[model samples]
Target: MKSYIAAAIQMTSVPDLQKNLVQAEELIELAKGRGAELVCLPENFAFMGEEKDKIAQAEVIAQSSEKFLKTMAQRFQVTILGGGFPVPVSTGKFYNTALLIDPSGQALARYEKVHLFDVNLPDGNTYRESSTVMAGNRIPPVAPTKELGNLGLSVCYDVRFPELYRHLSQMGADVLFVPAAFTAYTGKDHWQVLIQARAIENTCYVIAPAQTGNHYGMRHTHGHATIVDPWGTILADAGDKPGVAIAEINPIRLEQVRRQMPSLQHRVF
Candidate 1:
């Protein structure tokens, strides 16, 4: 278990859930062919549609008999990180959440979006996530294989908060996964920089899978699925293209960087 290969699948999802699942299956097969042990899909990989009504309609929760997740993981024989989906909430609302499926098709962990994206940028694109989606409370990390160790799980907007990464790292995570459907305005300006900063500061590898291109309605995503090293180096990046990127994680690099900086130990604030 020296190192493992991973891939991030970018998609231009639409209103049709079945069609999107088919596309995702094709991408999973592609990733398997390319020797990816773990593959991550972009946020809303299942169904991106007209508006809140569309997402709310497609909400699914911890149901055990989900064919899309269970069958896909078994078919690929690899860890499938299904990026955020619309989940039915208690108050008849929905929550954007990520689900992790193991090779055997069993769900390992599920993490809901903590920090919903509610912003009115200068581009006149106002997003009110709270209107439809419910906020999550706990920070969940997945313990995959003994060789791979613990992985911090986060959704799109969760990337902006450094405290989240810090919490994950403190909880013994060696890698962090952030699946996003970021807008073009923010992705172009801040996506890479923010991800790298988090990785460098935490001394952990950051694997981000993103949605690229326009969806069914007017929603557009900035697609650049990237993997960054602990030293803040951009190991792999896909620029506005739907494809996969791979990187070999070196544990020695993390140890070396941590030894050099020791920033994690220098917290006086």
Candidate 2:
């Protein structure tokens, strides 16, 4: 079957690791119970805190070894994509990384946030992500999936750059994951549009899980977790709340759309 059930998990992450993990576990279980074969969590699913202060608590990938990611994938017997965790790279540098775990709880791929969220929105939501988060040099596209043919891995802010999605489409990615923790100000206006645009342009399914509601320190995120089909159709959407948006990833439909439009082939720029 070309169709697979997937879930977009939304949550308000806090600074405490245990608290966020608990929430993640609960939501993952809920999604599994609802028959989700592939579940995705929001950006900074572990901890979302202040600039440099947060980086101090970052963990090394090798030494830390994602216990929560592995446990959830194995327990649910589903593929889990844990979005944006702070991982220490060197003495001071850190990477905002996402991990993709297989049903067997094995880590399939890791994609660091190539484009950091470094913007000062008019609503006083100022962020300087590059201050502590090291930039990723590589663009990881199309991680292998048992259900979806090839899934492109991307995090928040990265969705703004169409070139990334174009590259992934060129790499034969049928589905793309864009887990984000966008601020309320920007998300309200740009989130859905960007998502649909990506899906339509690439002729691929876009699965975007987001952080909704107020988080730790009263920081609010624009939650409207959405799943868009290749035709720019919003299959499932979650408004300003913490919940799951479940949808079916149909590769055949994607192929049909690509065959009809063939935009990826018509790219001259």
Candidate 3:
């Protein structure tokens, strides 16, 4: 096993793709300066203007958006989770997509958001993300590396579903990611607890980068980009700002936690 540093970047992305990308690049460099080997960005880190804008900005795989991320990863010599972007699935529909790029700039894996947000919030704000974004086919999630341990891929809404995390763990995931853009209404109450629960039950490291502050004047995201260890202890947390939280992931600690609990092996269902 190996030990390495990880970082999660919180952002309050606006309507501009270029500006968002610039912010992400600067943040990635900053994380690298802090000796981070793996970096994750928040959901919708590229554009968050409107539904029409999201549709228009959607890119196909291997296109400009992915190219930019690969270039950045190679330049910084660090593995990067490209966060969530809208990828075209059809003429008017897109998939909420996440991709990981290695230090060599090769795309390692991609995870489209499986669970879509379609609910009415307590603040009278209603969203039907399924209206524009199509549901992913729900494939087995995969991330991380030989040295970093297995990483399970997830998006914002997927956090509410424990079975998905369990399935990923059964698929050999030792670490989990919940790159998100959770609404302020729900995040203030449910975010941290859900993320830590996933870590505790799976006995896996959980990295969750998030959107923060206000966007488009109509939406505000709760920003507490955090990293939790297998023992359900928070390793790092970024407050309500656009920044990176850095922490060292100790493999020894992860192993010890799993070894002591052994609950995963005791599952009957």
Candidate 4:
């Protein structure tokens, strides 16, 4: 794997699908212009609104999101990760899916979010993701690439689960993707810490694209789209804005950190 720049794109997506796509394209262009070869978009890049509204338009959102990723990757000549989007399932619910597309517009990997957020926060915000999103039964996949190294996939809430990233590290992942629309209440406290912990513990670079600001109604996300190195250093942070956080992903640095820490090799259980 060679060194290249990666981007974590932040956006405040609303209920409108086309508007969100336009916004995403602009960010992608910005990242590409900044010399980012691997660009990632935050969760709900296409549509963010009431759960009922999301469910009602799942098919359209799914189709549009997929098409947008492919088009962006091909046009920009960069590998693109659509952090999370709703893909319809046979049971009338959708999977919160993260998809990776190569520069040639082919899908490299896909991950359906396994963990569902079902909680009532202290701020009086309630979320029942399982009501609309069917949890993935299998573990997320790590896609091996000659130039990009092994890339692992996971969604927003999954960042709280360390074992998933452990599995990816065991599978020889060099980088982990945690695309999220993390709630503001939890994000304010847990977002950066969790991401850095994953990177440090697994000794892998982490690219986390995030949604920030108020999407609609009471749904407010903490926006800090970040790229972290293997040693848990914050490379670039797009703080609470609709923008791109660009950083270098270097194999030499990754190997150096792994050899220095040797934590992954020391795992016992």
TM-score of each: 0.93, 0.95, 0.97, 0.99
**Total clashing pairs for each candidate:** 0, 0, 0, 0
Alpha-carbon lDDT, every model: 0.81, 0.85, 0.88, 0.95
Q: Please state the error at residue 29 of candidate 3 in Å.
A: 0.6
Over 4 Å off in model 2, which ranges?
Answer: 60-65
How would you encode candidate 4's per-residue C-alpha lDDT over 40-122 as one tens digit per residue?
99989899999889999999999999999999999999999999899999998999999999999999999999999999999
lDDT of 1 by residue, 1-269 (tens): 24787888888787777787888888888878988888888888887775565544654423321567778789878888888888777786677778888889887888888899899978778888888788988776755566555777999898899999999999877889989999988898999999999999999989999888988546778999999989999998978977777777777877788899899899998
For residue 165, model 1's alpha carbon misses the true position, in angstroms, by 0.6
Score candidate 1 by lDDT. 0.81
TM-score of candidate 3 versus the correct structure, residues matched by position = 0.97
Better of 1 and 4 by TM-score: 4
Tens digit of lDDT per residue, candidate 3, span 73-98? 89999888877888887557998889
Error of 3 at 256 (Å): 0.4
Q: State which candidate, 2 or 3, has the greater lDDT.
A: 3
Q: Which ten residues in a row have the lowest lDDT in candidate 4?
A: 260-269
Order of candidate numbers by lDDT, starting with the best: 4, 3, 2, 1
The best-first sequence of candidates by TM-score reads: 4, 3, 2, 1
Q: Give me the displacement of residue 5 in model 3, in angstroms.
A: 0.4
In model 4, state the lDDT of residue 188: 90
- Which has the higher lDDT value, candidate number 1 or candidate number 4? 4
